[model samples]
Target: MTRQALVPTTHERGITTLTLDSPANRNALSVSLVEELGRALERYGKDPSVRAVVLTHTGNTFCAGADLKAPAGPYAFVALLRQIAELPKPVLGRVDGHARAGGLGLLGVCDMAFATLSSDFAFSEVRIGVAPALISLPLLPRLDPRAASRYFLTGEVFAGTRAQEIGLLTEAAPDVDVALAPVLEALRRASPQGLAEAKRLLTAGMRDAFDRDAEDLVQRSAALFASAEAREGVTAHLERRDPAWLQ
Candidate 1:
């Protein structure tokens, strides 16, 4: 609980890898971790020599979503996701394990995501009586509408291959680095100005749109999480039982 939440490593190849390091909580997006991640990315944004960012995790879970016990507002997280999406350089998500809820939103913001074939994902907010409102900013843009609707409502787990099928990941390979290497190399080959401009072309105005809508979405998330039903759902989940509505 009192250690570094994110670890940054730079390689000679102009890649900076940010590992979600709080494995004790399965890399939950606590306030401190989220803040640290934002800071790292912001620093990377200012470096012209950094060609790409690799977002990976250190444990069996890529990310288990937000730490429910961490009493913080969604504003920071909303801003963090926006920052990643708008970073001039490409961000590659390398998922070797499971990710849930807010974690899957991170994948949605990636320029490309490479995942191990066995990884799993879910938009699990609805199950906890909260809407995936803030996550929807990035997620809705990339996800197949039908798939998003089904998974968002049902909170069912899906395989990495299925995630790729629905556009959450660019590739689902048996080996994570193997699939990611060529992509990184390709990014490396591109001129920094070219990558930044091309990224602008690919994502023009999306950041502005997120900025415009984020406050309302965060408010919705906060209201739902603070609701009576959400309290019941959280209790039932922790107790390993169905909520009263389900029973």
Candidate 2:
């Protein structure tokens, strides 16, 4: 297979690993990266040899969120998140470190998520004067609305334990390899046809909800991007200072 900045590697055991390789920026999701990811996922979902897919990242952070330095313009990241959520095959998020904002959106899209004990998770878009748009559709159904409201409003960092408690993660392990083993094992034990059918059954009820939420998210996110607070917050972060809006 051809390689790109985002590395897509498949193991003989039918576990495809897609690593977000932009370590310098903590694997921040760029538009090109998301597009490549969408393509890779589409290919894997169609390949009969590929039984399951694992999404991960390199370095100390899983993903820091969208690459704020690169202008997303509009709906770019949101579309990518929807692609992940709608992928036909089983997708597992193997989170080793921190997953914030759009990064957390990736976790939500996964059919299952396994985070390391040391991993941190947060819906931190609020800190940047935006909402967690892409992930909220998946998250709202999994999490209590009250819990979602609290985290989305505060943008506070929470540990893996809290992530599991809030229904954001399947389980927390001591390390990445350990976290991935159970998911791989489960995939191995299930017939591919059965897995697909099961996934469809589970997701059928949420289809309408996801659709409505996606529409709402796009509208609100676009409005937030145009707000003065988003501009100030993003500028302050890029400049390595506190946001004046916070003060």
Best by lDDT: 1
Cα displacement (angstroms), candidate 2, residue 82, comes to 2.6
For 1-247, candidate 1 gives per-residue lDDT tens digits of 7754466565658888998888877888888888888889999988988999999988899888888777346998888888988899998888999999989888888888889999999988888788888889888888899999999999999999999999899999999999988888888899999999888877765686696898889889888988999998888877888888874
Give the alpha-carbon lDDT of every model: 0.86, 0.80
Candidate 1: misplaced stretches above 4 Å? none
Q: Which candidate is the best by TM-score?
A: 1
List runs of model 2 lying over 4 Å from the truth. Answer: 1-4, 71-74
lDDT of 1 at 199: 87
lDDT of 2 by residue, 161-185 (tens): 8899988998987886876786698
TM-scores across all candidates?
0.95, 0.92
- Residue 229, model 2: Cα distance from true site in angstroms: 1.3
